[model samples]
Target: MTAAASDINFCFPVRELESERVKLTPFIPDLHADLYFQGSAAYPELYDFIPWEAFTDTSDFVKKVIEGCVRPDTGIALYAVIDKTPTGTNPSKPTSANFAGIMGYTNTSPANLSTEISYALILPPFQRTHVTTNAIGLLLQYALDSPPHGLGLRRVQWKANRLNTKSINAVQRLGFKLEAILRYDRIFVGSKTNAANGERERAGDPRPGTVGTDTALLALCWDDWESERARVLQAMDRRS
Candidate 1:
């Protein structure tokens, strides 16, 4: 459908999205512990471009997930990424799924029939595996599906730090095209220690020499998805 003809009141339903390797379910307080464990384990590596550090406990993690990530009023829907493979020592026996990470959609603009996918965080074990690939494939399929099946959005965007080559490569491999770079897009303040001067500064001190991050914008519009859907789906299935 054309962007103008698409429903302006389109709302993303909170539900589960599954692929061969991963399952995405609506975020809940009950899953906070598992989310915290996985996210905290990844720690500073995952936080390099994510703009947030690992949580100290379930309470801290749940508060951020509720207040920051899954704000329904703002049209953001967060999901817990669960690993579908067997986790216990018994490979032949089924085991409870483990929380691998989190991902979701934000910056939704129904009037424009567009939304940006953001806040994807997968643990070390799942990185470079087919889990993320399949998760994104599932999301794309749902976002682009026609009425009675999905939202049929005209545009789906992906943004990342310009210096984050890993993230950029991941999305590009998924068929998103690089659009532009937003210069000095976000400011991040933190403590600095001067070895020569033996001086220490606390976070948010607002001192000089602080640098901000530039955002690299990428997108998969309806036309792009239509043209590339088959190939992308084939790649996902092949990799699965």
Candidate 2:
């Protein structure tokens, strides 16, 4: 039997994380999947760097994203990035929620006290806005701040496709330093020739006809948080 949405545990406490500009809450498929599918379908091209193709429907999102990347056993947490800033189009509804995107913590390790932030999908309408900055900033706080304030994780890692300059830029701006370039980081089954928006894998490889990618790994450690946290807040405060 399928467990109830609220009953599902992510191996970490699911809390409502927010800032003046953005809010991130646990993503419950029963409620947000349809909305996510509608938004994602409109901008399939946005998933150019993702290992898998754009979702065909809500069911596909649940089957692939939920079943694949978001595993409770693995301690992954998916969040709904909600825009909270007052839109000029609807000035009267200052607190209205506008669904912006999605983000997640993957490869979370409670014992090791680390996690990786991955799968950020900012909808077209919300791109290049404060949503991205505050959304990411909020997660950083939740993950790195000391107990009673936040999770106090020792490290937060971000892995982006080497070709994804925008993502690389975002993480760098948030104070993550480049550690290494992970070659052949992931395999996109059936891609056969190209590596999901990245360079093609080397030819004559043992696993022939497999699409792969090189990952640019960047990390923000507890040692850097005190200073970077201040920088992140200033960036999130900017209006664009």
Candidate 3:
């Protein structure tokens, strides 16, 4: 395998964090099966755009996690969010790594130092919890931290289907500035990819499904990220 390249310095491998009632950790091999099932079941509609088959097997998912942790350039950094059920209470609830989601750059556009951001999968009991917010905060914080890996970061962005209001609101609530809705700018469910790079062969697939046309592109920049992280952390402090 190629030695981790330009992006190796950009990631924090195996990061761990506590968010009120949950623990966010790097994706572990054992949790792959559950994570795969949870992610696929949680968002079937997103299949057209994402490659879910790669995670069907425990080994494959484990490999993916390993790659994300050790490989640069290619693999997106992944984090699994686990609920911390308090055993100190009346009844003890099982605590385990729940689902896997990722955040990283696909490509940085030349016009500006902007990068795309994507995160998902909060299976079953984990849905609608503070974990998502906390994880997102961590992602933004990591992106804007300081020199070295963080120096080139100017914008963090999210793009989803025109009808994906839930995604739109979620990013907006986190204070991402909605930039533009480029008409027919994406190609989903087909072979033409319109990401920062024009249509090209996928990393592994020569003939991937065409994910045609999407409109909304929500974005958060270093300025907005600073304010949002402060608000989120302050709110967390108040709750504690």
What are the per-residue Cα lDDT tens digits for candidate 2 across 1-240? 233555355766778787877778777777677778888787867767776678788999888887665754457888877787645532122222477778978888999999988878888888888988888898899999999888989999999888888989988998999999988788766652333545544767787666777789999999899888999999989975
Instruction: For residues 23-132, write the lDDT of model 3, one tens digit per residue.
Output: 55544444434555545554544443343333455556545645554344432554555555435531122233434343434444535666566645455344465656
Ranking by lDDT: 2, 1, 3
Ten-residue stretch with the least lDDT total in model 1:
1-10
Best TM-score among the predictions, by candidate number = 2
RMSD of 3: 7.6
lDDT of each: 0.68, 0.78, 0.53
Clashing pairs in model 2, backbone N/Cα/C closer than 3 A = none
Candidate 2 C-alpha RMSD relative to the actual structure: 3.9
* Residue 90 error, candidate 1, Å: 13
Candidate with the greatest lDDT versus the true structure? 2
Off by over 4 Å in 3: 1-14, 30-34, 38-75, 85-114, 147-152, 190-211, 234-240
